[model samples]
Target: MFPKSLFPIALLSIISLGSVSAVDYSETYVGCVPIGTGTSGALYSPSVYIIEDCNFACADAGYTYAYFSNPASSFCSCKNTGPAPGDISSVASGNTNCGSFQATVNALATDYSFQSCYNSPASDDTTSQSTFDSCFERCSTYTNALVAPAGTTYTCLCSNTTPSGTAESCGYDGTFFAYSHTAISSPSLVDRRRRRLERMKRDEQLRLNRFCPGGLQACIVPGSDDSFECIDTSSELESCGGCLYGSYTNSTAPAGVDCSILRGAAFGGATCANGRCEISACREGFQLVDGKCQ
Candidate 1:
């Protein structure tokens, strides 16, 4: 658990597309504050260092913020509300540690070039006549970014469905350009892996629906998160064979009564037979007949 920090957004530095730095992301830098210094950051922690993935993940989750731990920052959450009085402190490394990641991402800068295409959309960052570096940097946030200098109707266009045209020479004048992001694995692959794990968990639970002790059965109590409990109804005093309030298991659930709670049978000596209640003794001044106290 990291110490929870609640500094105002004003204290952070939100980098724009024009900023000449190694790091490029939507969220601002909050210094080199370590994870132990703060509490858990967010629910989405990437196993690998794909800054874009972290940003897209936080944004998709409807969060306004995403943070990184530099070389290996696995924190991304929207918990930054505001700092307490006199709680604003710096981590000493401001954008200095950012270069390590930037250097790795910047290698692709030379690989990207403007292509030739039509129906070009407007620039995502709103600036035009973008050089290769600026265009690539500005379009980093987009999944399928297509950009070129002015005069393509729209300065920049991002379309995941549209296949990029043949790679064309990059220039300031109007010409279509596309980025493949071949440097890293597809972002959707990460989501697929997570979904696969969840499916496996569900499948495992379903498999266990019929597995339990010889006479015991799995039962899901009401209000439980789909979790089931193993119970034996044949001899349980409170529940002879199953739950009393309700049963929500995937298989046919057994319903039984509380053997010790029988009113017709002896209050203190009632016993369960298979799934029925038996009166072994009667209350004081009462005689047992026809399986009831008379």
Candidate 2:
């Protein structure tokens, strides 16, 4: 990308397709106009132009190319392929020509609603070159967002919430360019994960509603058949805390439970602590192992 200012006299010689003839061009003149400054009241830079000539034959290619001899910078050349001249008449007058490339430059500056390069803001002029250098260096390594050219700043774009929980924002800043939030992953995967989590949560809710209704919370401890750790608010009985093995048997127990102690007690008492029951010596004897209280 060459500076648009080099269009007028800088020559463009295009090699026509399948032809030995060369189309040579040269800008003979250059000029500029003043554009306004920033809200901070800085002086804006002036526009530039080039005046030139075509020494060789022109082509029907409908493209105008210009190259600035200055190789010190990146944007030192310009080229454009526009509609071909309607007739030789326009070609002779340079009507479909690039003598006015300053027009594009002007448009670019105005497109962003900024001052021209020459009519820079007073604040911009007052800033030390070191500050600009630092800003420019910082802008180059940035990729989390778009980086503007050396002089501009970053701006934010508008955002709308998608059906998904993420938000998107984008905009152009003089220094940094635009920032947008996009899905780094495939939408299907994100959607799938969301659905899976929701389903698990729903199932857990349903289980709670059916069995633990109106009681202090309970959980279905993983890895069992309908196995759950529930609390009996009414009695604090080992039966409520312990896994229900069908009316009296100890089946599922919360972690650290001693279901064997629950025996035949009308109320699960001293035996149950923290969801587990402790077996007493008398209850142990009642087991009648070996056909005796032994």
Candidate 3:
């Protein structure tokens, strides 16, 4: 699929959409728009990705209108300012949107907050630029809590528990951008093999919760209904030091602190030190003084 940012400006102009350059175009402006840093594009969604979804996302980003086109793939572009009066029919031309699948993207996803693009914190990691599934897996795997963009890169960011600062009006640069999280995806993609793996992992974690280890603090992973790869609490980012919510299956396995998910310790500068989480950095505009991002 063609990248969302590469969609021609002429197409945007015809639909009364703003260019990626932050310039307000007349409703009749049918010229090509210059490709720019991926800022002007407010948000992107998968294929029942409706015009209303784009409108809602743009409105959250302080824009008046949104463009949803699926000539090849789903693309949602946000435009700022007002559309100067002009020939409305000429620009309306052959513009159309297509998202036939159900709202599967929103069903399984955890609730997420949206704003405009922000200076992506130095992310702990990034997923492959394939689809939302990759981003979803990576984010849930690491924190299951907070996820941010990695600057202007095409992948979802793996950052701290929360992000701070204000969102930009139009082209926010790497600044934070808001999304509705009401994504639309094909049925097969949503119920793919990777999703099954996630379910398996969940069941395995639950088993460990039921029959936990006291001595080694081990977690069960396999068998017809069993598995391997115990949760290494010592260095594991998700389960650092010890399990945060441990209980005895038939014995004791008390819960411990989870360090990698320190609130406000964004920008990916967190580490497990001596069975405790050490705050090494914070997100932009925050001072990491006295072991805290203030």
CA lDDT scores, all candidates in order? 0.42, 0.26, 0.39
lDDT of 2 by residue, 258-291 (tens): 3444444323223444554444433332553332
**Candidate 2 positional error at 224, Å:** 24
Estimate, for each residue in 124-198, the C-alpha lDDT of model 3 and write its tens digit: 655533333345444543432222233333345655434455433322233332232333345564456455445
Model 1 CA lDDT for position 56: 47
Ranking by lDDT: 1, 3, 2
How many clashes in candidate 2?
51
Winner on TM-score between 2 and 3 is: 3
Q: Which ranges in model 3 have alpha carbons more than 4 Å from their true place?
A: 1-50, 53-113, 126-128, 142-153, 170-172, 176-294
lDDT at 257, model 2? 35
Best by lDDT: 1
lDDT digits (tens) for residues 44-110 of candidate 1: 3333245555544433333333454445444443322211112212233321243322211111112
Give per-model TM-scores: 0.26, 0.19, 0.24
Which residue runs does candidate 2 get wrong by more than 4 Å?
Answer: 1-199, 216-235, 238-269, 279-294
Please tell me which model should have the higher lDDT, number 1 or number 2.
Answer: 1
Model 2 residue 290 CA deviation (Å) reads: 24
